[model samples]
Target: MNNAPQPHHHLSSDEIDLFELFHAIWKRKKWLIGCTLFAGLLGVGYAYLAPQVYQVSSVLRPAAINELDALNRSEVYKLPPVDALAKVGARLESYEARLSFFRANPALFEAFQRPGQSLEQSFEAFNKNAINLTFPDPKNVDALNGAIRLEMQYPKGVDGVAILNGFVDYAIKLEREQVSADLKVIVNNRLNEIKGKIDAARANYETDKQSKIARLLEADKLKRAQLEDELSAVRLQMKVERSNRLVELAEAISIAKSIGIKSPTTPSALGAAASRGSSQVMRTEVNNQKIPLYFMGTDVLEAERTALEQRTNDDFTDGRVAEIRKELRMLDVNREVEVLKSRSKEDIFLRDVEPLWAEEARLRGLDIDMSGLKLVTIDRMAQTPLSPIKPFKAIIIGLSLVAGLMLGALIALIGHFVQARRENGPFPMPDRHLPHPQKHTH
Candidate 1:
């Protein structure tokens, strides 16, 4: 009998037999089908439980900055640019003010209310899907197309457009109020600083002026006293000269009487006393009688006396010229003080501060229109969506079907391997060639 040793053909696990794979799969077909159908049912039930959501969206266009409009509008209130609206929108997220606003208007947001839930909780839940702000360029904030997009989602029964509009208006108003308050605070601080500087300047000017005025008044008084002293000395000199002239005149009259001449009593009054011994008398024929004429004082002395009298009457002793000079000097000093006071009142710091004060006032007062500061303009209102955006039945079902098939196939493969190991042998290891040991007959 030819009973020779047969060579063993070892198979690696990598060498998969398509026939064996089909046979294993076929053996677990019912289990795989059952797993698939169960997963699909779970998916269908999940889809049914999920609420349908409707989305409402709108676009905001930036308002053009018209120079004429800015001029015509209140000078203190200016509008913010379109790009600023995106920043404002970003700020609106998670703001406590927005929550308070929602609570205040409970009726408007009745759709957001949940039974036994606090207002804060309800509002937070609603915000999860309620609002979104999108910019044209995500990386660059300034590169805006002047269009800000707003999106809101709500349950199937709620009117998304109406709610979105209400929220938008509320947000815009809140943002504007906050911005105005912030600007008012900044402007007020600046104005206060400027006012303080102006006040200090005025105070310093007044203080300096008072010191200068005191010095000027004291100087003027000293000058007036000196002038009075000089005038009094002149008066004493004139009095002495007058008395000497009288004595000379009397003596001359007595001499004429002693000469046995019929002469006027004061005829020699003008004669020079120092030259009396050499004096010459002149005679003139008048009415056939010789008449003698003589002066009461020397020509030089008489001319000096005449000039002194005229000076006393007009300029020197009359005190009019000195009084005029003092009056003019005082007027000039007073005029200078007035001018300085006026200039101090108009300090440059005050001029710079008043406009800021006006702006602060305008911001504080809510009566003024601050629409110019609005960064966002609703270019298109949000439209009410006729259909639900979420709970996409077709997509959800398709994804679930794929996931179920993959899971069922994986479980089936594992079961097939386990069954094979129990019935025949262990799984073949890859990459190694091992021969089955042949039974040897000695």
Candidate 2:
């Protein structure tokens, strides 16, 4: 007490002992091992007992974007669509359209495919939904036909051959037409997006042209060193290549001449003048230019025409887009002539780009192409189980009981250890921490 300060309160030792824990584990070793092994076996059995699931998948190549981009850039007042929402909407719409077309005709589906077509083929053609299609062979016609019908029996209920054929055909056509119709709104939406992009491009081009018009006129008014330089370069190149160009032109003309015989332009007006002909060389001028059929001699007409031609031209990659664009270009231009060559290089490009004004509309059409939806099978076909997959009461109860037994063994071991040590250690000296018997009684 003199050397150090006396403790205000005494501390008590913890009751837990490691020996008891180890002893308990050893005593119930069989229960612990048996429970673990039982749980593992139960897990394996449950995994295998679960039902198998069946799945189907379809695939397709995505359409090109650059072609649309090029179309957009060529327009007067529009720009290419960079919006993700617009694109996703378009893609979704496209998928919807495909699905609509797929569902349109139940009859067509029946007609398009039958049993024995496939269990699982790598690639199968679908008209609308996932209906398969294969040309029916004559030998297999009866079987094929049976496979598609809702019932194995023909004529549905009644047995009139004429009535049945008519009904079946009518049903199929109705289905197909309905599919197209169902897709109409969505397809139209997607197509509209394409039209929108095209329109955007067109609008931008127009804006650009008008904005640049004043500039072009102003430049034209100036001494035009830049234009002069460009003109000179073109002239120089033309001069160097003139002979080869002429030869090429001649070859082109020769090839053109070889095609479909001209009808002599409403029966040759040469009549009596050529009746007395001496072999003096006859100079013939052949009409070899492709002109828009609808154009009269108007600039607007010409613009429209040029637009169609530009889009249809070889430079555009998407065959569908290219054809439509060219058509649109031709539609915008004035009457059919060599008007294409008359315009400067820049003008040509602009005219080509004008059809892109309808890109938004075209995009709208693409958006409805839901038939392009793809699928993948995560799990193969297995019958769905009607009951719950987990909580095996038998296994759970067995494990719980084993756990309880292990716990009991632990308690017993702990009690045994305490009793054994009880007589060995001297009682700790009571100090400030000693509990009063009076407090315990109170």
Candidate 3:
């Protein structure tokens, strides 16, 4: 025997099922074709119904090579080095610094916020919402504040989606300027603080000096007037005393001369035989007494006048009022200080910071001078067609048709099996063949 169970004398379950499928297709060809058509149409519709989108990429770098030294701080007398330079060490990377600018300075943030029908307009519109800008929520603000992050990786040719490019470049430049402005604000606040202190100190100094000077001047004037009066009176009194002393001395001298008082007996008894024989003879003859009276009264008067003048000079020349004079002199010195105090004005330490503050204050009205930020184009303005840059309509439709055909064939196969089973009646079974034949033989 060939064995193998004689190959079952017919087909197994797989072969039988395959033959059934083959037979069903032949019988229900119309239905199978119809299902295939449906599936093909479905696939065709899907492929063509998808929407198309275009995307553009841009590249930008942070503002570089800013001439920070161009800003002048030379005249500032007391500014700290950092304050003078207005350098916070490139804090533009810190969203916080920029955030503060946006929060504190509306116009500043607004300028950064892209405007008018732009890809970035979503950020700008938020500025109008008072709640958003007024009370910053970092979660909400991070995206808005993110400096323009340009993607320069791909060279999407000149026809690229360049719409968002200019704004982004402009934005980064604005940011650099804004950062510089923020630094300036810091410097300004510091300078203002020093200015305030200097002003207050000056005002206070002026106040104190003025008060003391006025008082000192008044006292000096009063003292000088009083001294003048006293001196005049003293002079008159001195003159009178001098005259009296002179008169008294002159009268005494006159009396002495008239009485011949100078002829007293020679205490050096006959020390010199008196004027020899004449002396003895003349003395006895007429008692000749010659009074030494050459302007004796006038000499006494002159001596009296000299003594009085000496006393007046001594009294007037003494440094008795030195303190008052010194006080007056001090007042005069402080007067100059007061003039400076009154005339002096506060200096603007961060000159450029002012426009920044104003720009920050009035965003729409920004006359911001970005010249100082020293911006350069690391990535020049260039455009490329947006990707899926070239829309291959033909290729897309071709792919669509191929996919549709396959889907259609698969649907047709399943539908054909369903319709064929119904048409062929229930599954076949072997004939009974009047099975009793075996019983009868038995």
Candidate 4:
């Protein structure tokens, strides 16, 4: 039953077979080794020939409380140590601050200059990744004790330590200047506010003084009017009384002449009887009634009426009139109003300005000098590094050797397929038919 022999079927070329592929690669082991050696040699050469890059770093921490005591004690401005450290860090990371430092110190960045590159271009390149700031992670519990690290990556010949330390100093100085300027502005603004208040107080004092004078003058005016009215009334009364007295004296004189009386006399019964007999007793009879005007003789009444008529000023007739005249003269010029109006320095009289002046003086005496202020404490100054950070020799050689092995394997596979195609047509042919072995004769 077709036992002659069946041709063993070989695997198709369209599918991959790991065993055959491994076998092919093992056949070209020398080529893989040689390529690996060549690539490793190239890596070593590059590691030695390439320019080295060094890194210098410094650590910054918050300043001590005593270092910032003066600033806080100023009362005008307060700067905490932690915040000061943060500000210094921010300044260090600033592009403008870096550019300013680069421009101010030309010799420090001389290594950054190269052929065909302008000074600006060199600075730009130098500024681009040369400086790095590393802050402590906030999630860590020990972050409070951690510090900010400033690192600078520089090429072979540059003084990285000097540049880093100088940058730190520059940043601190800038922060100090800014703090001092801010303090000055705050103090000056407060001073101006105090000055304005003083001026307003002075104006208020002047206004108050003027108001007082006006009140005094108005009161004096009203009092003078009342006094003048009283004086006029008194004079009118005196005039009317004088007229009445003159009329009375005429009546009395008529009565005295009709009775043949010529002098002031008292009407007594005995005297009247002696002078005019019983007929005079009727006129001389005295009762509880007041004395009659005719009892006074015509000569005395006529003299009193003449005196009253001739009196021009009745001021001496009543003591009240003299007192009113004196009071009116005093009211003519208000002494208090004159004193208030003549005052040149009115602030001294104001009671509200004492505290304000004291406060102004206190503010003026405050010390705003921040020259000795310390913003940050340098935990570690930048030191020159002993070795370069770039060009990892071991890693470079390892990766190159791996890559060369891969490339050599691919070339070996391609060469094996090409040679197979030439020997056995387009695709690789299966194993050829095998010859049978002859049977042994007994």
> Best lDDT goes to which candidate?
4
Task: Name the TM-score of candidate 4.
Answer: 0.82
**Sorted by lDDT, highest first, which candidate order results?**
4, 1, 3, 2
For candidate 2, the 10 contiguous residues with the lowest summed lDDT are: 146-155
Q: Considering TM-score, which of the candidate structures 3 and 4 is the better prediction for this target?
A: 4
The models' CA-based lDDT, in order, is 0.64, 0.41, 0.45, 0.83
Please give each candidate's TM-score: 0.59, 0.22, 0.43, 0.82
- Name every residue pair that clashes in candidate 1: 79-372, 79-373, 269-296, 270-295, 270-296, 270-297, 271-295, 271-296
The whole-model C-alpha lDDT of candidate 1 against the native structure comes to 0.64
Q: Which residue pairs clash in candidate 4?
A: none
The alpha-carbon lDDT assigned to residue 356 of candidate 2 equals 49
How far out, in Å, is residue 241 in model 2? 88
* Error at 338, model 1, angstroms: 13
On TM-score, the stronger of 2 and 3 is 3
Q: Write the per-residue lDDT of candidate 4 for residues 61-154, one digit (tens) a residue.
A: 9899999987788777878887888889889988889989998898999988878988789899999999999987879997766699988999
| Residue-level lDDT tens digits of model 2 in 1-442 | 1343343453345455677577756776765566556655665555445442222221221123442343334332122222311232233224444344335534433433456765122113342323222222447645322222111112122222322233333333443344346446554665566666656666776677666655544544453445455445555554455445445444433433454222222112234335757555455546556532221223333344344444422323334444444544544433322343354654335555545445544544343222332111112122223433234546655665666556556556666557656855656443455544332221
Model 3 agreement with the true structure over 1-442: per-residue lDDT tens digits: 2323221254432244756666655565665566556655655565455443334444333233233333332222222323322222233233444444345434433333444555235333432331111111337644322222233222222222333344344444565666557656755665566566656655765676668667766776687677666656665665676667666666755664664444333323234445454464323323355633323444454465467555644344335445444544554454544554465433333233454444334433333344644443334454554344224455655665566555545555677766656776568455444223222221
lDDT winner, 1 or 2: 1
C-alpha lDDT of candidate 4 relative to the true structure: 0.83
